[model samples]
Target chain A: MFGVTILGNNSAIPAYDRHPTAQVVTLNEQLFLLDCGEATQMQLSRYKVRRSRINYILISHLHGDHYFGLIGLITSMGLLGREHPLHIYAPAPLQGILQAQLDVAAIVLPFPLHFHALQQEGVLVAEDKFSIECFAVYHRIECWGFIIRENRKPRKINKEQALAYNIPGYFYERLKNGDDYEPRNGETVKNEWVTIPNTPGRSYAYCADTIFNPEVAAKIKGVTMAYHEATYLDNLIERAANRFHSTSKQAATIARLAGIKQLLIGHFSSKYEALEPFLTEAQSIFPNTQLALEGVSYRIL
Target chain B: MFGVTILGNNSAIPAYDRHPTAQVVTLNEQLFLLDCGEATQMQLSRYKVRRSRINYILISHLHGDHYFGLIGLITSMGLLGREHPLHIYAPAPLQGILQAQLDVAAIVLPFPLHFHALQQEGVLVAEDKFSIECFAVYHRIECWGFIIRENRKPRKINKEQALAYNIPGYFYERLKNGDDYEPRNGETVKNEWVTIPNTPGRSYAYCADTIFNPEVAAKIKGVTMAYHEATYLDNLIERAANRFHSTSKQAATIARLAGIKQLLIGHFSSKYEALEPFLTEAQSIFPNTQLALEGVSYRIL
Candidate 1:
């Protein structure tokens, strides 16, 4: 199953039992950690996320709220005897930070940590099952965003159609994947006659801390699911823009402009105790908007 | 008001709702944080600790469980615009680590942070009200422990005796501080006649991470309270020694040998779930032993 779980939704400061930004994106058997905040390790335990399965970590920036938990999580992974190679994609400076932290503590990780400094905004990882892409965002300092695209879905098999076509049972496997079957009798059976078209591949976009920029929308247009930062209410539009953050309405505007299927809004400011205003405001512009609550999983339909 | 609150009790990994080693020592109005582990900031919030009120942070070692949350807490303090100077006492390498992290993120702290490298085992801070001292411990790497000594307690003023002695209200304040009252035209009244002796100011010692060493007891003898790390049970004594940790019985032995009035034992290994066995084993050797439960305050009487 493919889904995204919110580990922490708060911004810079941890308040109201809400933590800083961190999320767990599970695609098949692999888990991708996007922006590990200070509480990421503990939150992973709270949400029962298998740490060993997290093969990739994508950090948007060097901001403390975005990647302070990287060293701790990596240390714990070492302590747990994880041998799998962990790949980290982040800003160029993170490699130095991680090295200094580990060197000072004399920690030798048991796994091979491949640090891929995100210098440009493009594909970071491309596997047979999925692909990951990064893009630049307008922020106070150097920052970036990420989007994950899953592999194409398999064609659905029609049992009645397959039997009616008199195709051999052994060829049904290929038929379900849109492959034409040719019997020894010199008769060709078209794939469309036995299988129906399944839905296309799904995509999830993570727009890390950024201002109200339509370019962000243009980069990740028509995504199946998108998580946008709504750091403030509509009333604080000026305050949000001045700090290089976005308000609920601005996030919703981007979602509406991008024409995405669903919008998940989070990165709430510590000043606000109630998140209902953000959801209600965002939903006015984007009807399929939902608050990114901690521990709640959002699956792209 | 002189008490120690446990923010985290677990040793290396966070388990069973327990975090790593972090404690809040409240001395009158001042709060001193000891060994900030991964969840220190969140645990501080969970227990309603005023983050701004903490003036001193003491880190014993460079272990991730001992000081992983240092940067996060400092960053949060900076974001909150704390102007008062914060003092951090840890090993020398931590300064480089902190500098690298702050430089990469371009975070200019609002407050002045004074980093005091712990080199020699001696007095780190000596004030009129309290004194903080550090000592070396037996760990895998270079580690140190801290002991806080409060100033002498004031004499309790005996109201009836003061009235009988004809001491004026203005002179009572001085009398409580063990000062003899000299009237304008009369003979001096002895301090003992007006005031009775109060209990002496208490002392609390923290033995961070160490093997079973009898010298630890000799260093902190007669302390009002002492907290020692007990990473395993008595059966795992060999394992504890190999890891440079202490078993429950060993921690209790040190407490008993030191003749401390009370003992608070923590730093439990993640392998154990139920803590009752630890309490039972420690109490068998030291009757005044208590499990260092998170969020609970243990006052030094």
Candidate 2:
């Protein structure tokens, strides 16, 4: 299953009720953390997210609201006796910060830490059954948005057709790979006659901490789900632009232009007590829009 | 008026029900933070401690459990448009770490930040109605303990003697300063006959994150209240020694040696779910010992 869980959704200042920016993206059994804000570990525990399964962390920027919880989480992992290697992908400067904190505390993790610096734009940071591509976003600091796509599955074979043709069990693998074989009697068959092509894989794009830029529409085209930051309302359009952040309408416009199936918007200003207006404004432009509420889970499909 | 409010009392690993180390030292209207752990700003809000009134912050060490919340707190203060200057007393390396985070986010506080580095032992960090002194402690890192003493008040004059001698208001100041009063008529009055000595002031010592070291007893002698770390039980004596931490018995012994009126011990290991044993073990050595419960206020006098 491919999905994303909102750990925290508020902007710069974390309030008593709303928290800062943090999200957990689940790809099958492995979990990938996106932008760990302060109290993210608590949020993980509060929401019952198993932190032991997290193998990768992706930091969008160096803002405190984006990554302040990193040191605490790393320390907790060590204390909990995590032995598996953890991978971190972020801007180059984050390594120095993390190293300094660990060094001061005299903490030596049992697990190996592999840091992949996102110095240049349009690079593939990680890939496996799922591929994550990083692209530049317009922000006050160096920030990048991630596009995650699940690998396509093998073609499915028609059991009735294969059985009627008397295909051997050993030839099933070849048939799924679009190859058809003849039996000992030299009977031949076309691969398309028994197997159907696999369905298109789903894709999700996370546009982290960015201003409303039409250029982003080209990068996230045809995605199944897209999470764009909408930190303010239309009334605070000038303030949003000054802070290099997007509004609800602008985020929805990008999702509409990108042809994404669903749009989830969050990172609201602390001044906003109610988030219904954000959903209303975005849904006016894109009917498939939803609010990124904390502890809420959205399936990628 | 002189007391401490426990903001967080848990050990290194923060649990959902408990938090990491943090305390608010309230001296009249001013508030001083002691060991701000991760999410301390939220803890401050949860306990209704006014973060805006905090004028000073004392960092015991560079452990993430002690100072990780500082950057987020400072960032939130700036975002809230705090105009008052904040003073931070910590080791030298913290300055670079704090500056790097601030530089990355391009956040400039509206108030001035005065960073006082603890280089040598027995340095007086602050002096006002209460004098703060710092002394080195036995820890894995360069840690320091703080001693806060309320300044002694002037000696009170004997009202009956003063009225009979017709002492003027101008001359009362000299009498309080231990000087004999000489009237304009050339009559000399002995200072002891006119004024009585003031009462001795109270003091609180915070021996934060330290091992059971005898040297600390001399520095915290005659303190009214002492807050020491008891990270393990007697059974884990070897582990406590290896980690440069103290057990409940060791902390109680130090409190007894220091002759403190009351002892508050905390920083329980995460391995143990209950804290009753800590209090029991400590009270065996020091009868005035108490456990540091979160959100609880303890009087220094």
Candidate 3:
């Protein structure tokens, strides 16, 4: 049920039938927007991604290719009569920018918009079932990478065993929490005997616009999958470094070092007309590497 | 040689395979961008419009649908190493918004970007071959409409007559300027004998994002073609008025009043799946009415 859908996969200049950097991270019924580039809202609708279900938006940096479509999405939400509060996590300056635009247009949102500035990278979101942690990355401007991990699920109760023990149905919630069943006879039934652990939770890491930095590999280690920017091929390593971007080989190497189960590479430069070379280059280094194609959803198993 | 290519035609919410308002006005070799909505750069590329030739961009209002794609287009120009200067005519607030984004991204353009704020309605560009003027429009915000007019062409020279008159090849320029040739013998070669007037110049008016306002009809009179925003159908006249938008019938009425030869109606509401009703409604009043389909060029005859 947890997956990442790619809305756009191109780099600074959107060309060759590809768009800029934007994606949707789906965790069950809730959707989290990742780096909304231009036309992201349209792409969401095109892919049948429910815009109303998206309550969280995470922006990696101030690059136009990364977040130019944010204001439009926000405005569209208001026009569509979204009543639920939306949360945006981005650089501090983004709040002022959004506020200025809204003020000039004299637009009052129908819902509340909460802005959470990413001044210092840490645990930005922590819930009972999942958590999101952000860490700094090497880029020309302020940027960060995020790791979303689903917490271990609670134990499942054995319904037949509970009924046989004469446990009341109203106490199922407590039983799922590893509580023993106690009847009026003053006899206590063991919790482990009537319950079993649920399946293990999965994790996904998003490495946004960044150069080749191997130091953060440990932070993303053992994740179900990792998405890293491969803006150029290995032949243009100098160009990639100058632009504060990453090469396919460099991204794949980091994914291999981090022991990720699947490696997704995208944010391709407009100079490249063919994306097959990027997949080839990355797979040469990490055999599990896959090209991040637009509109395709990569499940985190 | 003068035409407008539609990039997007939907209203506030881009859906149902349509996009927001965006168009490219082509005057021979030059292209002027009009109301750059989301993913305008992609549309320009899709239509094979020369991005390098687009030296001017006109933004009608502060609405996100009108200009949300501007920053991305400008940034892409810089990333593509555009050395020619780009001029943008928009509301005063847009310059600051673009500057803030560029500053935060730490991106310095390779070319000069000139911002001309549209505080009043006046002529923005006056060249020998063409001229562009902006006029106020009745919208929710401080919006403006653009009128692009190709200048009166020069006279076509009769090469045989000029050669027989012993008129120097260098004097051909003067001949086109409606000047008669004179030899040392004091015999004047009448201008009428050597040249004929070229075809009359054509004009196209863009009435961007506005409600029905009859006062400005005189300003656009005698235009070859006009593009008006038909945001809603006749049935939603109340809704259109509440949102400061216009219906197809209203747009047609204005086009007819302005004496326009051809009328293009667009900026359709996303609520409707079919656009045929818009054409039918508009054409009922103005027979020359046409639907502004994306990638279709409406030539000013």
Candidate 4:
């Protein structure tokens, strides 16, 4: 039920065949966007991702490659008569930029748009059945990585045990919560006889637009899946550093150090004509690494 | 050599097969961009238009679909190490937006970027061998249409008559300027005896994002070719009016009234699955009208 869909994977300048950074994370029925590059709207349509289904967007930085398509997407949603409220989480500067563009066009949205500013690192941006946390990453501008964790469900109650104890339906809730029930006759019930512990929740981390920083490894440790940017080859390590980006090997190193179950590496530099070298480089360091190909979906579990 | 190459032709919402508004006007070796939509850099590459050859960009307004691609394109050019100066002509507000984006990226151009503000309707945004003039257009924002006129050359001189009159090579410039020449030996050369009048110049007018207005017609009168926006169909006339856009019929009306030699209409509504109706509707009023098909080039002559 939890997965990530790649909309665009190329880094820096978008090429004719490859687009800039953009991805869609589907958590159950809800959709959240990550880094909307130019042509993201087209990519969404190309992948058959319903624009109306997207309720939240997470922007990593103010770079054009990361957020240029946001205004266009918002405008198109308005034009299409989308009535669903949308929330965007990004740096505070993005609000002014979006507001100025909207004001210039004299457009009034039919739905509400909420902007949540990511002013400091290590803040819990949103939490519900799924929780999202933001932490700073090393980039040319202000940027953050996100960790999304699904909330664990309560333990399952043993119906046979409850029935044998002559417990009513109302007492089943207490059993699921690891609480033992007492009947009106003062008969006690053991917790172990009624319920079993809940299964562990899966987690996914998105390290958006950042250079290789060892500090991030601890924060993303033991996640089910992690999407780390690999914007350059190992040979271009200096170039990657100069651009405040990471090489394929560096991305794999982070994933390996974090002990993540699987690694998805993308954001290939535009200078690269083929992606085989990136995969080779990353897999050499982390055997569980995979290339982030466009339109491909990867399950969290 | 006077033709327009469709870089992008879709409306605000870009489709997988179609893009937002963007086109390239090719005048011999020179290229001028019109309405740079999102992902225009990729579109330019897809259409095989040399990014280095684009010297001028004319923005119609502050709409995201019209100018969002500009920053990305500029950034790409910078990354590619392009040294050619780029000139952008748009309303005053656009300068701030573009500058802010460039500043955010901390990009210093290898070439100069000149911003010309178009505040009013009239003569001369740029004048050289090719003269560019901006005329007021009826749009929701402060918009202008561009008229590019290739300067006419003077007629060739009669070699035999020039030799007989012993006209110096230095006097050839004067002779081309339609002045009678007097030789050092007191011989007079009549202006008409040695040179014939020059041929008429070619002109192309870009009527960007606008509603049909009679005033626009008069300003663009006698243009050899005109590119007009047809954003909606007749059934959506009310919507077009509300959006300050034109239907195919309205675009044709302006072309017909302006007495243009030919008309190219694009920026079709995404609701339209086919463009036959637009061409048919426009040609009903102006027989020379043609649909602006992407990747298709149309000669002005």
Question: Each candidate's TM vs. the true structure?
Answer: 0.90, 0.94, 0.90, 0.94
**Candidate 3's TM-score:** 0.90
Candidate 4 — which pairs collide?
A: none
Question: Candidate 1: what lDDT?
Answer: 0.93
Cα misplacement distance, residue A247 of candidate 4 (Å): 1.8
Residue B80 lDDT in candidate 3: 82
lDDT per residue for candidate 4 within B66-93, as digits (tens), equals 8888888998898889887899988788
The candidate 4 chain B region of ten consecutive residues with least summed lDDT is B120-129
lDDT of model 3, residue B151 = 93
- In angstroms and one decimal each, the interface RMSD of every candidate reads 1.0, 0.8, 0.8, 1.4
Q: Distance from true position, residue A120, model 4, in Å?
A: 2.6
Off by over 4 Å in 3: A156-172, A178-197, B155-198
Compared with the true structure, what per-residue lDDT tens digits does model 3 show for residues A1-301? 8999999999988888898899999988778888999989889998999999998899999998899999999999999999999999998899988988898899999999999999787899998878888888889999988888888788998888887888888988988888888787877998987889898778889999898998768878888899999999999999999989999999999998999899999999988999999999999999998899999999888
lDDT ranking from best to worst?
Answer: 1, 3, 2, 4
- Candidate 2 residue pairs that clash: none
Residue B152 displacement (Å), model 3: 0.8
Model 3 Cα interface RMS deviation (Å): 0.8
Please give, for residues B106-218, the per-residue lDDT of candidate 3 as tens digits: 88999999999997777999999899999999999899999999998899998888888888989999999899988888789999998989987899999998889896687
Model 4 off-target regions past 4 Å? Answer: A123-127, A163-166, A177-193, B125-127, B158-170, B184-193
Clashing pairs in 3: none
Candidate 1 Cα misplacement greater than 4 A, ranges = A154-198, B154-198
Cα deviation of B24, candidate 4, in Å = 0.8
